[model samples]
Target: MTQPQRDCVIAGGGPAGMMLGYLLARAGLAVTVVEKHADFFRDFRGDTVHPSTITLLAELGLREKFLALPVTQLCTLDAVVEGERMTLVDFGVLRAPDNFLVLAPQWDFLDFLAQEARTLPGFDLQMDTEAIGLLRAPLDQDAGREDAQGTDSAGDVLGLRVRSAGGDQQIHARLTVAADGRTSALREAAGLRAVESGVPIDVLWFSLPKPSEPPPATLAYVSSAGMVLTIDRGDTYQSGLIIKKGAFPAMQQTGITEFRTRLVAAAPVLAGVADTLTEWEQIKLLTVQINRLLRWHRPGFIAIGDAAHAMSPMFGVGVNYAIQDAVALANAITPQLRQGVVPERTLAGVQARRERPVKVMQAIQGRGHRVIARATVGQRVLSLGAVRLLRLGSPVLRRILARVVGVGLLPEHVRTPPGGSR
Candidate 1:
């Protein structure tokens, strides 16, 4: 049987894959996205687009549509320190045209991307298709390849093997992209080494009724509240409590009353909804861990998003970095297509261009986890001082913190497309 062919075959349909598909399709590449899930929309995932992502959406001509959705402008971030609450970071200081971060549902953003992506001419975004294998096209040096015959310029991508209801199928492409999440099959299949470090905190997420009065902004609890957080969900306030990994099982066994007791202990204001709690089933627990790939790419394939690096949720930087990876990948690969070739150097360049910043972010996020995990009084005092210094240290600190909350302004690699220095 003849092998199926496409310009680019992408695995996974999360934000990273969708964003890459959107841009590649817009750039006139034949792009097919294979997502395992029948329906792409799911809950209990990252929602906020960060300030930088919002800027990218505007660049993509979807900001107005994004804003039109039921969303809020998050202007502040508060944390409880030493039994006293204070602002840790404020989005209001972000120097973007839209200074506030948008609060909406992740599914809402997915709907927006799906609706917009379907309209592009070159896009074949397929749902319910599970990618199972990566196929390496016979390199020119391989025997019997003399007859396989490469195209005049556009090289055949390393191929892919997929599973569907009909049967196992094979598809080939010039570029195979792995946008799968942290537990990425593609990443493992590619033989990439990934290192994951568990943070000291375990995150438990549950929904409660909106406070009778909403809090000033997103809320965080220092070590005193078990380093938990209560964030402003669109319709309700969602709380994330950090607890010992061993403690969760006991909490689960004790049931709702015990759970609410723990919650009230973290933030007393949440007690109002504690009584109204209908189902604890809505509560989900995630083991907070950070990971990074030894390398981001190989000869015919590349991994992006959580596949490349997984960061702790301490600063909520995971989604921002994932989307940024999509942007960087698109910008780097688009030029190679125009050149009418997909050289090994080009693939290597994408990995090299992206890896440094990825390491930088991983380091920064790891440090944050260390600071938050510190239980020493002196360290706690230093942490408080650090927050204060972040606010008043200098114009640079203010700018960095502003963007960190809202998203925008960063190292050159994150700011401009690779090779765009020209």
Candidate 2:
């Protein structure tokens, strides 16, 4: 059986792929997104929704619907540095209305996008479907054909060869996109490799029930013992202890009691419920990484989000950045996709537009990793010099951090018109 060639076939149904699928379908382009996972529900996922993404929801007329889902709005990221508490990031400093960081489960966010996309006639999402390989065909062009025609049958990537419960099938399309995330099978199959930046921290993730009188939900505790990030998830607290890279095995030998003690030392507020972490089964190790591909595109294919750049869990901007990539790609490619084939230059332009922002964020995260690693080495991360600088430039610091964390480096708005082809 032959599948109808679509305007686009995205390899991963993640943040970038789903959003791009939604935007493209809204623009009247046929798109099929395949995800290996049967569902979006997963443990210990990034939960931060930045302010620019919040603005995007409003642009798509999805603000109310997205807000209706369970979410916590964080106006400030409070950090306790060397026993001194200070607000490291102030979302309040950003322009009103869009100001605030939203804490939402990554599953809910992905589900929301999938649901919205399905309503579009051109959108098709397939869960439990994995891209096993790429479909490539040498350019066979006619000189008289236009750019959107045979000219961009272009090179190599024709679509994706995927596998599901029904077995193997081919999704042939004008263009293919790899949004499969870090360790992406599609990216690897494309022979693309990301250049890795060494990260000093690895994180241990677990959740604890809220205490009767739990302290106010903040961002992190940066103490000499180690850094502990606590995310507010309504009734429970999603927390991660930042430890030295490849140190989980040694940390395990010290026993769970020692782990609890160390976590409590970093975040005193968690002292009440820290003892509840009795078994090692409850903890999961997330080896932190920051990496980006030297080339994010091939002839007839392109990569976005973690497929292009794997982000560290620093400011929790990974998901938002991925969505931003989708917006940029959709904005740049929709016109060509509507006509037919998305030209190679257009795909290259999308990568060019997004690469700088990804690099800048990764650099900041790398610096943050170094700063936080000091705590693991028994040194104060927030030295007096830094504290004084922050205090002296308090207003300036708030504005800068708010923009960097909540709004991002280069924010893209939805440009693809809705119901264009629908």
Candidate 3:
């Protein structure tokens, strides 16, 4: 069977992949997004949509519709440290209108994008379709050669070797994007390696029913005993207990009673509430990681989001960064893609533009690893003097954090030619 070549074929229907497909199809280009999963109903994906993302949605005329979804907003990112309340990020300080952290389920967010993208004539989304490998043009019997402009200068990437319910087949395109995430098989097939940073903690995720009188609405509650990140999800509170890396096996050996004790100690608000969690099966482990690729592009191929940089769950900025990458990519390459084959320079430009922002965010997250490690290991993270200093400079710190976390650095807008409604 013959497969029609598209303007772009994106592997992994993640935020980066879906958004890029939408933007390109909006620009009147044929684009397809492939997802391994049958649907987008996964638990515990990053659910925080920052002010910057909300602003972009507004540019796409999606702000009102997106906010219409069942979502909660957090005006401030607060943390309770050693019984002292500190506001980490004050979204009110940001310039973006209605600046707030919108907490919506990842599935709802993805579905919303898919719904919008499907209305565009050129957008195609293939669910339950997984990319098995990369399709590369043979180097004329020579091993490898290069051109002057980008990473893989030989126009090596053809498209993707994808497998679906119907079986394996090839999808050819002028450009291929690997938005397949941190454990990206496409990234490995493209032979791009990401530099891994040492992460000292992992999160134990579980759900507890929303108490009749719920605790304060804050990002996290911390103490010498441990740290619990509280996320309000309507009827239930999706809570995460940060623990030292590789500690799950030992903690499992120790039993569920010890786990409940740590949870209660972190947030005394849930003191007697954790007693219901008697079984280990209810808890899910999320291995925390922080990594970034040295080069995000090669010839007709490029990577974005977790596929390019695996973010630590510090500020829940992973999804935000991925969305930015997609916008940047479409903005940079649309004109040339509309012309036909995209030169490697266009792909490289997207990486160059987004790399620095990702680096800065990851560095900040790296700095946080120490504090989180100490907190998870039952050490006092904030001193009396430190708390006083925070009190004195909190306003300044709060505004600064708001700008970085809420609006981010060098936020991109939609610049591609607008898509038409079906």
The numbered model that scores best in lDDT is 3
Runs in model 2 lying further than 4 Å from the true structure: 138-155
**Quality of model 3 by C-alpha lDDT:** 0.87
Ranking by lDDT: 3, 2, 1
Ranking by TM-score: 3, 2, 1
Position 330, candidate 1: lDDT:
80
For candidate 3, lDDT tens digit of each residue in 120-212?
988999999999988898776554554343234443899988998898889999899999998998877776778899999999998887677
Clashing residue pairs in candidate 1, if any?
51-406, 52-407, 157-173, 157-174
lDDT of 3 at 255: 92
lDDT of each: 0.70, 0.87, 0.87
Flag clash pairs in model 3. Answer: none
List the lowest-lDDT window of 10 residues for candidate 1.
146-155
- Cα lDDT for residue 116, candidate 2: 91
**Model 1 ranges off by over 4 Å:** 1-4, 138-157, 276-280, 374-398, 408-422
For each candidate, what TM-score against the reference? 0.85, 0.94, 0.96
